[model samples]
Target: MATSLFKEILFRKKITDDLNVGERKIIIFDEANNGNMGDQAIVYAQTEFIKKNFPTDRILHFSIAESIGILKH
Candidate 1:
């Protein structure tokens, strides 16, 4: 079965001249085919694509139980 993959990236925003900062989390979700065959490989490939396209400070991943359509804004 296919699952929706979620990647959240956190970035530090400088708030003060003395190095104080705040962290912001940006969430991105992508739906992919993850049937009984080649699910892991597909997921890995998708991850690499995201990493190359949207390099960030940190990344967090999760799987959604349901499939979803992707949209860009």
Candidate 2:
């Protein structure tokens, strides 16, 4: 678990360095994909809003659950 967390952290930094996340970084700290329609819609809407409003900004989504998507997928 600790290793996974560490890798996730490193990957985040690497992505920032690689993609050059500028002043506007939209970070969704804790995301859930537990098949909840409301939750999914919230995330979707949040992302869409960001994309429409902050077109040039970057989005970093972190999942605080048993299955972390960034590393797994």
Candidate 3:
């Protein structure tokens, strides 16, 4: 299971690396603002991490539990 998971990660990394940043669209689905402090913090951290790593890519986030959509730069 661990080996498969590692391979999946590497495959995803390769796919992401091959994509053009200018045309890439990243969608983040999380349980955001659902009255769970931990979930909220996780979502916030994920958003910041993505923004920091992919500064030029378009990022869209949606609350999987609440259907709240957020478009972030």
Candidate 4:
């Protein structure tokens, strides 16, 4: 839906709006959920991939609910 897409954009903007220019950071979204094993494995693989490829940049985690909550403003 358009509203969902709009909320996603707003939430992403909210999370990154305060960052400085040329920030070297990677955000892993929805990895903080209490999901099943498949989801956990996906998160683990993503983390390992980022760690292997981008050893210097900082990593950040955010949940889907948390992202949508930011759009409630």
lDDT of 1 by residue, 1-72 (tens): 121221111122221233223543234344344564576676777678777776763333434422132222
Tens-digit per-residue lDDT, 1-73, candidate 4: 6556645664675754545558688877656577688888888888899999999987777667765654464
Give lDDT for model 3. Answer: 0.60
Please provide, for model 3 over 1-73, each residue's C-alpha lDDT reduced to its tens digit, 9 standing for 90 to 100: 5545433443544644534346877777554667889888898888899899999877655456423222221
TM, every model: 0.36, 0.60, 0.53, 0.60
- Which whole-number lDDT from 0 to 100 does residue 8 have in model 3? 47
Q: Who is ahead in TM-score, 2 or 3?
A: 2
Q: Which of the two, 1 or 2, has more TM-score? A: 2
lDDT of 2 by residue, 6-37 (tens): 45674755753643334667777567677999
Clashing pairs in 1: none
State the RMSD for candidate 2: 5.9
List all candidate RMSDs to the true structure: 10.5, 5.9, 10.8, 6.0
TM-score-superior candidate, 3 or 4: 4
Ranking by lDDT: 4, 2, 3, 1
